[model samples]
Target chain A: MDAIIFLIFAAAAVIFGINVVLRTHPVSSALALIGVMASLAVIYLLLGAPFLAAVQVLVYAGAIMVLFLFVIMLLNAGSEKKSRGAWMARLAGVPLLVALLTILSFVIFRMYPRSVGVKFGSFAAGTVERVGSALFTTYLLPFEITSLLVLIAILGAVVLGYKELD
Target chain B: MPANFVPPSGVEYIRVLPEIILAAVATLIMVLEPLTPAPRKRALGYLALAGFAGALAGAAAAGWRTGPAFSGMLEVDGFATFFRLLVILAGLLVTLVSFPYLRREEAESGEYYALLLYSVAGQTIMVSAADLIVLFIGLEISSIASYVLAGYMRREKLANEAAAKYFLLGSFATAFLLYGIALIYGATGTTRLNGIAQVLSDPRMAPAGILTGTAVALMLVGFAFKISAAPFQVWAPDVYQGAPSPVAAFLAAGPKAAAFAVLLRVFMTAFAPLTGRWLAIMWSLSLLTMIVGNFAALLQTNIKRLLAYSSIAHAGYVLVAVTAHSEEGVQAAMFYLTVYVFMNIGAFAVVAYFSRKGERYVEIEDLAGLGVRQPVLAALFAVILLSLIGVPPTAGFLGKFYIFQAAVKADLLWLTVLGLLNSAVAAYYYLRLIVIMYMKEPGDSLLELPGMAVSTRAALWTSAAAVVVLGLFPALIR
Candidate 1:
């Protein structure tokens, strides 16, 4: 059952990721990217990384995607024009890409044979409760520091974006 | 493992007192900014100054007890305290320098002071962080605040360009650093410095050489960019050239110092076993940084860009000390940076004052015959320049002397020789400005530099006094 769900989300994620690249208009690409993110979050859940899945949906698919759209709108970016370029990329890109994938697969299979695999709850430690427990104890300093980082980001946006100050 | 989380004790809060004070004061200034009238905005600068002073006192108070805090994320040791105090002082001096510069630019606001305080707060965290995650967050805080501060004068085209380039390139380098940290954690099964050290020292559990080496190389790339070392130093000249003079000063002294502190702690502690592997790399990097920084600086016509390159060369000298990777090397690097903070800040403070309205007079030649117009200010500028040249009776000479001494003890004879020669070449550019200020004929553009304001004079005198006193006493930092 887990494998079936993983396959479905994994396929969806790949198709959406490819759509993101094919779409020229930035907003379209951004929306496709969100689809890719959402699918990936489901895959993370299937892999038993429940906390990571939630964060993927909340931070990446939600907050970060919104940020991407805001930037696209702010810049009023148009669809990318076909470049009078990439001759070398066109010539070597596909063959090099194939060779790269072959090498990567060879390395992965050599490291972990087909018999070596994960069970449904292999990463059971990644439950949201455990993550929350760790966030306040072992990771408390970094968690608190993250608030300061966000504050700085807000202050920077105001300093750069505001029209006038008395 | 315990099922329940352990709440932090009270001492942990005291360990981070300096950062807490700085952040609170900064947030306070932010609240007051909207309430205060326009003419009273300088009062916010005074508030920021008080914040730095209070933070400095807090560092001293916190220094007496040294141990880990907050689950070993921060280590309140001698090294952390020293750098915390140094960065806060750098903030204090930069705030002093910014007072007149902002007023002259007609861009005075509480936000500037707030950002400076927050940036210093970030540096304090950076110097204390024992875990890579905390260090990375602290670095983000400092880098983000500095990026905004670099372009504070939103009206200036140069400031905007400075901020953009710094932001894009800085984020790229940070990604590289984060990858390196992840790789290190994968190899060692931990992000804590001493945990990594234990794993590295245990032969049975040792990480593969290739993995740790690659991680170190990536990290060095990030640190090199932060310190403006060679090959990754292309941004420094341009950013410094365009940034407001005071912000450039703060960037050169504060963030750069904290980055060096992180580099020293990580390399000297966690990666100590791999010294043989990285030592040769540090030697070459040091050589390259010195060669590039000094030779390129000779051609710069803009005074700010020249100092920017000069600072890069100084980073190379400190790198030589780090290449030694000995107790003496850390000591030498510490003393060298302490001296550098003052000398570099003093020089930039002079530039801030001399640049005048809208920063119109940044050319090296524009300093012609300043001795006739303002002898006192020119003399102070000369003192700062001479120290940068590593002349005797100035802190720069002692700093370089100690660094070379450490290099020799470590058998880095060749680097020592090449470094001495590089400093010789560096002297020519620093001297050129001093000579121009005292000898060359004053140009029409050399309108008698406006009477130095009290804040500007305070900035100049304090830094110069630090350079001179540290030069003579030597024991103060040692």
Candidate 2:
């Protein structure tokens, strides 16, 4: 049963990875990337890193992807045909597909030996409690620094966007 | 590996006093700007200059000190002190030069100076950053301020274009760097430089993952872009030409120096084992940059664009020094950068002087017979141009001498030879400017010196004197 679930998640990840490149529309490509992120989160859950799965959803899917989408919307992107000149459009997909295939092959080959060490069963080894402990103790400086970074970003945006008073 | 490290107590906060003072002073200037009306705005620049001087003194006071403050996020050491001095000096000169340019360019000068000081504060933090996260943040603060300064002349379309290009390219490079850091974090479960080194040293820690190599290469590319190395240096000429000349001078000098400092520290200390790989990469980059930068500079008619290419050539020379991968190499590169700051900024001040009133662009033809018209300024500019071309009896020559000597000591004889040839090729263009100023007939009947404010004039003459004085006694720095 666990093997079947892993296979399903892996297949979805692969498909979404392909779609992220091949979908002509940037919106579709972005949505496909989100799909890939979700599948990766499930893979993290299966690898006994439940906290990583949650954080992946929260950070990657919830915040960062939304910001990406907002920028896309703010820029008012046009259809895929209008996105780039014909020459750029032709060259873009080739590299994307090539990178995807290369990464896929490498992942498959590298994982073959490690599959035994990576148990597919759900485990509490990387639970929320463990993550909280790590965040507060071992990773405390970086954690606070990350929050400060976000605050700085917010402050920067406000300062940049505000109009000067006449 | 000193496990179970705890954050330092409040006393550690004193370690970053210079940076803190800079930030405070910058904020004070910004807040006081609009409240104090124009004409009084000159006070803002004075305040910033005084603040930067204080910060420089503070940094010098902390000289040669070694400690990891803020949980090893920032390390104060001899290396950091050396770069802090360079950065503060660059900031001081830039602020001084900008006042006259902004007064004439019709832009609000106060905010510009404030932003420059803020950026200097960021650069100070950057050279001292011991962790990847702190480094990234410092890079951002400096870069973002630069983008604003680049486009500070908002009404000028060229300035806007330059800023846009720089911002887009910078953002892409930054993303690549961040992703690289994330991969390193994933591999070692740590972002501290020492911790990463420890993990890489342990044979069992990192299991021959290709991703780790790719991540490092990507990070190198990102840094290469920052310092405007070849293949990633497309933005340098255009951005340098389009931005205001004073800001261009800052970009060419300060930030590039800071970036190289961090790049040297990270690669030499933490990733020493990987030198076998990156040394090969840097060699190609240095050679290509030398050839391309020198040859391209030959065709430029605008003095600013010519200096931009010259800067690229200088970057190549610095990279050759970096390729040495020794203590002497790092020190040589640092010393060379100091000389570079004075000469480059002085040269740009000459160009900015010509651009006053925005009525006349300082084309090569306009410089014809400047030797006759403004003999003193022309002579000063000639010394600076000679220095840039690595001629004897000037600061630039000694800088090149030190770097090449280090290169030879490192057994990179071929690189040193190639460097000599590149300098020879570069001399043609610098001499062309001198010839244009001296030999050619005047295109305009009378070429008056562009009127600069008192401080800008003082800055130009001061930098010129420093270059000649420093050239005469390079041992002072040693």
Candidate 3:
């Protein structure tokens, strides 16, 4: 059952990821990215990292996707134009990409054989309580510093987007 | 659960007192901006300056402590204090230089000063960060504020272009850094520097292998981009040329120094065991950066772009110190940064002063006959330029001297020779600007000189004096 669930989410993730790159219009690509992120969230859940799965959906798929859509709309981005590059680039690129992918898959298979499967409950330390405790205790400094980062982002948007005061 | 998991406490807040003071003051300035009238906006600059002074004092007071804070996510060690003071000094100088320019542009707002303080706050956090995640957050805070500051003059197309380009390239570099952090975390299952150090030291726990190698390389790329080192330094010239002069000065000095601070800490502490592997890479990067930066700087006619390339060359010199990977090397790098803040910013302040309204006088030729028109300003500019050329009795000279000495002590004789040769090449362009100011005749089209503002003059003279004082008394930094 877990294998089937993993396969479905993983396949969906791969398809959406490809769609994100292949789609020409930025809005379409943005939506495809959301789909990919959501599928990754499901995969995270299957790996027993429920807190990470929730954050993946909430932050990446929801908030970050909205941001991408906003930028696309604000910029009024049209479909990407075709470049007039060397034909040699395309000729070399495709074969090189395929070779790189093949090598990566070969390395992955060699490292982790099929006999060592990732059962859902085998490593179940990623609970909300555990994550929250760790974040406030061990990760408190970074957690507080993130507020300053957000404040700077807000200041950046306002300073850049606002009109000059008379 | 591990034994040393301390709960969040009030004392942790005290450990970060300087950051808290800066943030609170920044927020106060922002809040007061909307309430105050336009003519009273100058008060905000004074207010920001006061806050920076307070924070500097706070950092000095806290410098006595030397240990990790907030459960080892941040530290208050000697190194952190050193960078904290340097960052604060840069902020203070930048705020001083920004006053007249902001008023002249009619863009003086609370947000400008607030962002400066906030950026300094971020830099402080960065130098103090003991965890990779904390360092990244601090980096984002500084980068974001700097992007806004770069484009503060929103009406200018150049400012907008600089901001856009900086944002795009900076985010790409940050992604590489984040990915590298993720790889390191995966290998060691911890983002804490000490934890990673332990893991790397113990082969039974985690081997020094391909994952660590790739992670270090990726992180170095990110750091190199931030510091504007060679091959990844394509953005510096454009961004510096386009951004406001004070912002460009701050960018060249403050964030670059802070980036170096974090780079030294992260590489030295977490990857100490892997130094034998990464030192060769640092050596090559130092060599390439020196060659490319100095050579590229020679052809630049625009003053800002020339300084931009010079900044890159300076980064190369600092990288030589990093390549040494010794205690003396780190100290030399810190000393170089301390001197760099004064001379570089002093030079840029003069650029901002002469550029006048709308930044119309940025070309190297714009400085012609300045010696005849305003002798004091021209003389100060010459002093600053001479310092940049690493001439004797200037801060830049001692900075290069110590760095090369440290390199030679570390058996980097070839790198030292190459660096000295690059410095010789760099001298030609810097002296060219000085020659143009003093030797060349004034053109009929020269803009009428405006009277210097008191604040701008103070900033220039203070930085000039600082260059001489720090040069003669190198023990001040020690």
Candidate 4:
């Protein structure tokens, strides 16, 4: 059952990810990206990382997608204009990409054989409790530093967005 | 919870005292900015300067006591203290330069100083980070603040363009870095530098493989981008040219040094065993960076762009030390960076002084007959420029000498020779500025240049004195 679910979500993710690049309009690309994120969330669930799946949906699909949509609307971007370089890129890009993909897959298979197949629930360490404990204990430094990062980001936004008062 | 989980000790707080002080002061500045009146904003600069002084003291105190903190996520060692002091000093100089410029532009606010402090704090974290995840967070914090600071003058179109270009390219580079970290974690099953080293050494745990090689390459690309090394330095000229001069000065000196610190630590400590694997790569990069940077700088008319290329070449020189892979090599690189901060920032301070309002006089020709109009400023600028060319009696000469000596000691004779040749080529451009300042006739409109502000003069003279002092006493940094 987990294998079937994983296959479906993985396929959806790949398709939507491709669409994200292929779409001409900014809004369509953003929507396609959201779809990709959602499908990846489902794949995370199949991998027994339910906490990760929920956070992926909430943070990535929900909050980040909204921000993307807002920016798209604010910019009022139309369909991307087709440039002359596209044909040149297409001629050289596809073959190179295919070669890279083939080499990567070959390496991956050689490194990790089918004996180590990953099945849902075969490794159940990704529970919320486990993650919380790890984050607050071993990863506490990074967890706190993340707040500082966010604070910097907020400060940056305000400095850039607002005008200087006379 | 584990049966015997031990919480971090109270000493961990003291271990990060400099960063803690920086962050607290930055937050205080942010909080006080809105409450204070506009005309009284210079007080904030003084306050920020006080904070930087305190942090510098804190860094000194922490430097005396070195160990891991926050469960080994960060380390307060000699390397970290050296860079933390360098960055704090740079921050202090930048704050001094910004006060007069901000008042002139009517952009004096607590937020500007706050962002500068925050960026310095971020850089401190970066040098001290012992874990890859912590490093990434630090990198993000610094990069974000820098992006905003680059565009601090929102009214200028060039500033906006600079901020956009820097943001896009910086984000791409960071993604590359994070992916590299992920791949390394995948290969070694660890994110801690020591843990990764242990795993690499343990044959039973993991084999030295292709994944690790790829990870190193990717991370090198990221570091190269940050330091503005050749082939990955496309964004720097434009960003530097477009940014406000003081901010550009800070970016060139502080962040570049911090990036070098992290690069040295990661490669030396975490990937020590992979030295043979990465040495050839560093050699080629060092050679290419020197060649491209010096040759490209030769054709630049704009002083800022020329300095940008020079900065890239400086990175190349540092890479030569990294290739040496010795303790003396690392020390040489640190010493070079210390001297570099003084000379480079001093040069930019002069540039900022001559830039006038809205940074109009940045072209090499714009400096014509400056020696006659303001002889002291022009003479000081000459000394700074001479130092940059690695002339005698200036810190740049000693810096280059030490780096080359380390390289020769490592038997990298060819790289040392090539680097010397690049420095020789670099002399032409630095000389051109001096000639323009002294020999050429003043332009018709250049007769009435503004008098130097006390703060600007103070910053310039301090850097100038430091250059000569450090040059004479190179052992001070050593």
Candidate 5:
């Protein structure tokens, strides 16, 4: 069942990644990026990183991506018009992406074998509770610092967006 | 999620006092900004400066405590303490420089001061971040505030362009960094720095999984962007040239310093096992940044653009020191940063001094006859220029001396020699301004210093004094 879920997430991640790159509108690209984030969260869930998956969805997909969209909308960035003058110049980025994907595939192959030798169940399942325990008990400073970060972001947005006093 | 959560054994408030103070003060300043009158807005700047000084004192008081704060996420030791001091100093210099610059230009200065304080608060948090998540948050806080600060003068088209470019690149970089963090988390099943360190150090932790070399390289790209190392340094010259001088100073000193502080902790403590891979990459980056930055500076006519490239070259020097990867190298990097704050701030102060009402340009030829008309200003300029060129009896020289020694001790002789050669090439540009100031005839419409330029002069003198004093006694800073 876990393997099936992982496979589904893997497929979605690939689709989302492609959409993020292929989309011409910055807003849609940003939305597709969030889709990529969500699928990545699902992958994390399969890896037994419940806390990380939740934070990934909340922070990356929820808060951070919202800011990206807000800024995109505020800026009102238009969809980039397809350029006709130099197809090769624009297509240069495609080859780079293709190379990256090829390298990624090689890495994935190294991580997995057609006939798997190791059992996935043998690994310890780190649940959300264990993560919270580690965070509060062992990593508490960073947690509070994260809150400080949120506070800083709020203050930063206010300072940037607030009207100047007359 | 809460069931298995066992909170770290002890929670300590003293460990995080400096950050708490900065955050509280930043909030206070932001809340009070609207209430402050336009004429008395200068007081807002003073208030922020006072808060920074007080926070520095608090950090000093909390220095060298050898325990983790809020679990093991924050290690409050001499290392963090040293960087906190450096960042606070960076904040102070920026405030001093901005006061004169903002008052003369802006119709509203309150939010400017408030944002400056908030950015400083973010930088403080960055230096003390102990986890990848905290580091990312601190990075965003600094980057976002800086984004606004870059385009603060929205009326100017160049400022708008600079802000736009900085925002686009910064957002892209943050995405890469966070993705890298997520990949590391997926592999180790934890985001805690020490946990990842432990997993990486473990010989049997499935290096084939998230421990792949690609993740490390991706993360390096993220940090390299922040530090303005070559190939990733495309944004520095444009952003530095277009942003307000004080904001540029803040970028050159504060945010960059915080990035290096975090880089030291992240790379040295968390990713020590992968040094064999990263060291080679850093070696190439240092060499490339040195060559490209210096060669580019030699061609620039605008003083600000020249300094921007020079700053990039300085980043190369810091990278070389970082490649040493020892405690002494860390110390040298911190010291270099401290000296850099003075030299770079002083250089910008000189530029601000020459800026006229409604005039932002600092052309190289404008310096002609400056040595004759304003002898004191000219003398100060000479001192700063020589220092920037790493001449003796100035902080810049000692900074280079220490960093080069650290690299040589690490047996990175080639890097040290390359650094020395870059310094030699850099002298041509630094000295060019001096030659124009002292040798050439004054143009008909030489830029005149405004009545309000006294504050800029004061800033210059203070920074020059720091360069000289620190050079005279390096132990004072250490």
Candidate 6:
């Protein structure tokens, strides 16, 4: 049952990911990206990572997408005029991309043979409880430091956005 | 409760005392910015300086209780202490140098100092980080603050360009680094440096060599870009040229030093078992960085761009020490970076003062006959120039001497010889500035040049004194 759900969502994600890149209008691309994010979250759920799935939807599909939409609207962006492609990229891009995918998959398959398969509950580390335990214990420093990082980002936004200094 | 929270010990709190103080002070500065009134903005700078001083003392206090903290996420050893001290010193010096520039540019604000403090705080975490996740977060904090600082003068087109280019390239490099970290975690199943080392050091416990090698290469690309090493260093000259002078100075010294600390820590510890694979890459990277940094610098007329290239070349020299991968090499890199911070800051301080408003007199020729007008300032700048050229008795000479000595000991004879030759090549541009200062006749550039501010003078004299004093007493650091 999990395998079937994973396959369906994974296929949807791949399709939406392509749509994201291929869309001419920035808003369309952004909307497609949200679709990709939602599908990926469903896929993550199928993989037994409920927490990651929640974050994928809440953060990427929700909050981040809103920001992207704001940027698009503020810019008053229009459909990008398609240029005659870079000749070199047009000629070599697809073949090279295929070659890279082939090599990566070959390496992955070699490292983890088909005899060893994923069992849903066997992947034990992705649960919220385990993550929470780790975050407050061994990972406490990085977890707390992340707040500082957020603070700096806020400070940077204010500095750059504001006009008057003196 | 599913999540059993381990209450952190007092020792862990003390271990990060400096970072805590820096963040607290930075937050306070931001709070006080609007309330303090306009002209009193100078007081904000002093507040930042106080923060840096307190953090320096905090660092010293933290060093006294040296050990792993927060479950080994941060390790406060001598190595961490040295770098932590180095970056805090950088923050303090850069802030001192910034006062005059801000006053001159009529852009004095508390955000500048607050951001500087935050950047230094981030660097403190970076130097002490034992986990890759912490390293990445610290790196982001520093880079974000620096990007904002680079474009601090929102009116300036060049500043905007600098910030945008730096942000884009920096984010790209960081993504590469994150990908590498993910791969490493996949291979070793851990983010802690020592755990990764323990796994990799045992052949039976190690994962596929190809995965580990790829991870190293990606991370090297990331670190190379951060330090502005050759092949990935196209952004440095442009970014430095576009940035405000004092900011350029801070970015060069503080973040670069912290990044180097992370590079050395990660490579020397987690990736030690794979040294055989990476040593050759380091040799070539060192040579290429030196060659590119030197040869490109020769054609530069802009003083800032020239210094930019010089810093890239300096990074190359440090890479040679990394290639050596010995105790002495680490020591050499450490000593080299210490002098590097002082001399580089001193050089930039002179540039900041000379540039006048809007950085008008930034050309190499602007210094013509400076010795005739402001002989004291010119002479101080000359001392810094000589040290940059690696002339003996100066700390720069000792820095290069120690690095080369380590290289020779590690059988990097060719790198040493070539690096010596590169330094010889480097001497030409640095000396050219000195020659123009004394030899040529005074031009129109010096006519409007204002007398030095007290803070600028202090920054100059302190850096110059450090350069000469560290030279005279090598044992102070060595």
- RMSD to native for every prediction? 3.2, 3.9, 2.6, 1.9, 3.7, 2.1
What are the candidates' individual DockQ scores? 0.49, 0.21, 0.59, 0.64, 0.40, 0.68
Weakest 10 consecutive residues of candidate 5 chain B by summed lDDT: B3-12
How do the residues B92-118 of candidate 2 rate in per-residue lDDT, one tens digit apiece?
Answer: 988888887877876654567777887
List model 4 lDDT by residue over B150-213, tens digit each: 9999889999999999999999999889988988998888899988888887777765477788
lDDT agreement of model 6 with the native: 0.92
Task: Tell me the whole-model lDDT of each prediction, alpha carbons only.
Answer: 0.91, 0.81, 0.88, 0.89, 0.80, 0.92
Error of 6 at B346 (Å): 0.4
True-contact fraction for model 4?
A: 0.67
Query: Which residues of candidate 5, in runs, are more than 4 Å off?
Result: A25-79, A84-92, A113-140, A151-166, B1-11, B64-66, B209-212, B444-448, B452-455
Clashes of 5: 6
Cα DockQ of the candidate 5 complex: 0.40
Score residue B453 of candidate 1 by CA lDDT. 86
Model 6, runs deviating above 4 Å: A81-106, B1-5
lDDT of 2 at A56: 93
DockQ of 2: 0.21
Superior by lDDT: candidate 1 or candidate 5: 1
Clashes, model 1:
0
How high a TM-score does candidate 5 get?
A: 0.88
lDDT by residue (tens digit), candidate 5, B75-169: 67887888888887778877887877776776456667667766776777678777787778778777888888888877778878998899999
Clashing residue pairs in candidate 5 (N, C-alpha, C atoms within 3 angstroms): A133-B5, A133-B6, A136-B8, A137-B7, A137-B8, A141-B70
lDDT of 3 by residue, B195-241 (tens): 89999999778643666787888899899999998889989998999
Badly placed stretches (over 4 Å) of model 1 are: A1-24, A81-120, A163-166, B1-4
Q: Let me know the TM-score candidate 4 reaches against the reference structure.
A: 0.96
* Per-prediction TM-score: 0.93, 0.87, 0.94, 0.96, 0.88, 0.96
Number of the candidate with higher DockQ, 2 or 6: 6
- Kindly give the stretch of ten consecutive residues in candidate 2 chain B with the minimal lDDT sum: B1-10
What C-alpha lDDT, on a 0 to 100 scale, does residue A93 get in candidate 6?
92
